[model samples]
Target: MKLVGLSRQIVLSMMAIALGVTLLVILTSYAFYFLWRIYWPEQACEDSWIPTGPEWVWMIGATICGLALAVVVAVNLSRRILVPLNSVADSIRRMAQGDLDARAVAGDRSLGEASQLADDFNALANQLQRVTEEQAFWNAAIAHELRTPVTILRGRLQGLAEGVFMPDESQFRSLLAQVEGLGRLIEDLRVVSLAESGHLHLQVREANLAAEANAVVDMVGDALQARGQRAILELDTQPVRCDPVRMRQALLALLDNVRRYAVPGQVRIQSHAKNGWCELSVEDDGPGVPEDFIPHAFTAFRRAEGARSGGSGLGLAVVAAIARAHGGHAECRKAAGGGTVFTLIWPDLPETGLPGSNRSGRA
Candidate 1:
């Protein structure tokens, strides 16, 4: 009953095929009869023109054989086509029922169309499964990340309310810091999510990459200095179209990463044009990321093992997200002097004289 449509189509096809065969047979028989009449006019005029017993037997046997062959062929062809399609339909049903792992089964002997349908269904199922799994992971991770800050805030507020801790300026400052951290985490997650979903809008304007880099460094100069990190600039004027606010956010994330992990040494920030693309990079001579973990460096919440693994691992991911939002990419590699170099590269925009063109200098 479920295959009524397919059955009707197959039946119509068989009927058309049978009609064609019947027409061909009728035409051939008429041709033969006409030729016989032309060649043997005397025989054609005979009164007794009936078939012999042997001829009747042969005609009946041939008709039966042809019908049997057609039935067998139709059954086999229908089976070959229907099986994979049924498998795909079943998989789709299961998927609609919330079984993301459901997949179509296409046997080796399946017809081309059936096999292709199965392949396409399986591909779609695979993508759905991946997206489902990722959503689940993100939900769990977000909960985990938020739990600590929420718990701390609750504990601290409870203590203050119960008079267990004094409401001193320092205590309030500590609470404020935690709140700020929580806010930053939320914002970071929002940015990453929007970028991944292709909804991160940028206020792109013609500006110099070197200028953005310089401004970010200047804004964080005090903090970097306090962390015993010396800033060195190797910047060149390279025009690009980007959101300065987002670009600065990305730069701050990079610098914050350096403050947390990089060794107390020179932090080289550079911007230049290379092969029609502008690159802004930050290099640190600290313990570099592990060779195996470099590939997943830009993945959200993924941190390398050892000393390099600390804090929420979303800074680099946010950098990558921002770069992608600007039609660019972020990359990490080993620096020449033995550390990690993080770079943001995007196609250069039309040259324009935006502000903040500072020559190479130290901070």
Candidate 2:
């Protein structure tokens, strides 16, 4: 009686057919009984209109054959439905048992819902695989990045303790610099994590976009001078509502990129209003990012071949995150002067307030 894997529609249709067959047999038998009684009243019994022995035998045989046909059809139907379901179940089990590659195959001409379910399952599996790979890659990259500075710090401390190196001012300063670099790397990782989780606290206010750009340029002035690089500022004086501290941090990240990779060249910092947006751009006339690497320029922990010195590969990513937090985005494009231009665009706030005015808001 248990019809495993049988769909309700199929079961109902089969039941209706069986009911119709039964009704037909009952009606035919009753009609014949009435005809016999009407045509031959002498042969008709008053007590019952049951058929004679051979006629009864033939009716019973027909009923048995019809029921047997129904049973055969039910078995075949159950097999057809259960086979695919069993296959899908097996695949799910395999995937649950750490077989990320296992997939359910919905063959051509499969039922609509079954095919859709299979496709969705495959898509989820694909995403899981991708996340797993990314997690592994990030783990290795972080380990490698941390190891170098840690080894240097350990070696310098050991040398000082063992009296193998003098604790001169220059040596102490070098040690302090290494510790600062480690601290910065740790801070960058923290910020990236917060940004990724959407938990980065922002004190948004109305600030002059041009002013923030200029401030960042001034802060990196000493580094630019040391590298023989000159920064050209093109301030448009556009006011925007944003988190000033976070925005400056993002701009500093961009400037840091120029210092690390495009030193000894002209760096341009500009702010302008365009198409209902306030844009901040930093362009440098140095070796440009490779065409293939431009697409992944803002991905966390992704580094380009030419610019791998003294960086944690999270600067541009932080820029993109901060832009997105401001209901905007970041883009990397080839500059007109044969270098790279990094642009951050934010939706323009209403011009009801003066530039650099502070209005309390949360993000």
Global lDDT of each model? 0.79, 0.78
Off by over 4 Å in 1: 1-61, 108-110, 307-310, 350-363
Alpha-carbon runs more than 4 Å astray in model 2: 1-85, 108-110, 349-363
Sum up the clashes in candidate 1: 0
TM-score of decoy 2: 0.79
Model 1: per-residue Cα lDDT over 97-153, one tens digit each: 999889988854425557777989999999889989988988888888888878989
Tens digits of per-residue lDDT, candidate 2, 1-363, equal 654322444767588668867876788778767887788788676555666764687588768867876777777666655555666788789988999888877643334455556677878889888888988987898898899889998999999999988999988998899898888788778777776777666666678878877788888999987888899999887676778787898999998888888848898888888787778889999688888999999998888885757888888988988887666789999887789999999777542332322245433
Evaluated at residue 191, the lDDT of candidate 2 is 74
In terms of lDDT, the poorest run of 10 residues in model 1 is 354-363
Highest-lDDT candidate: 1
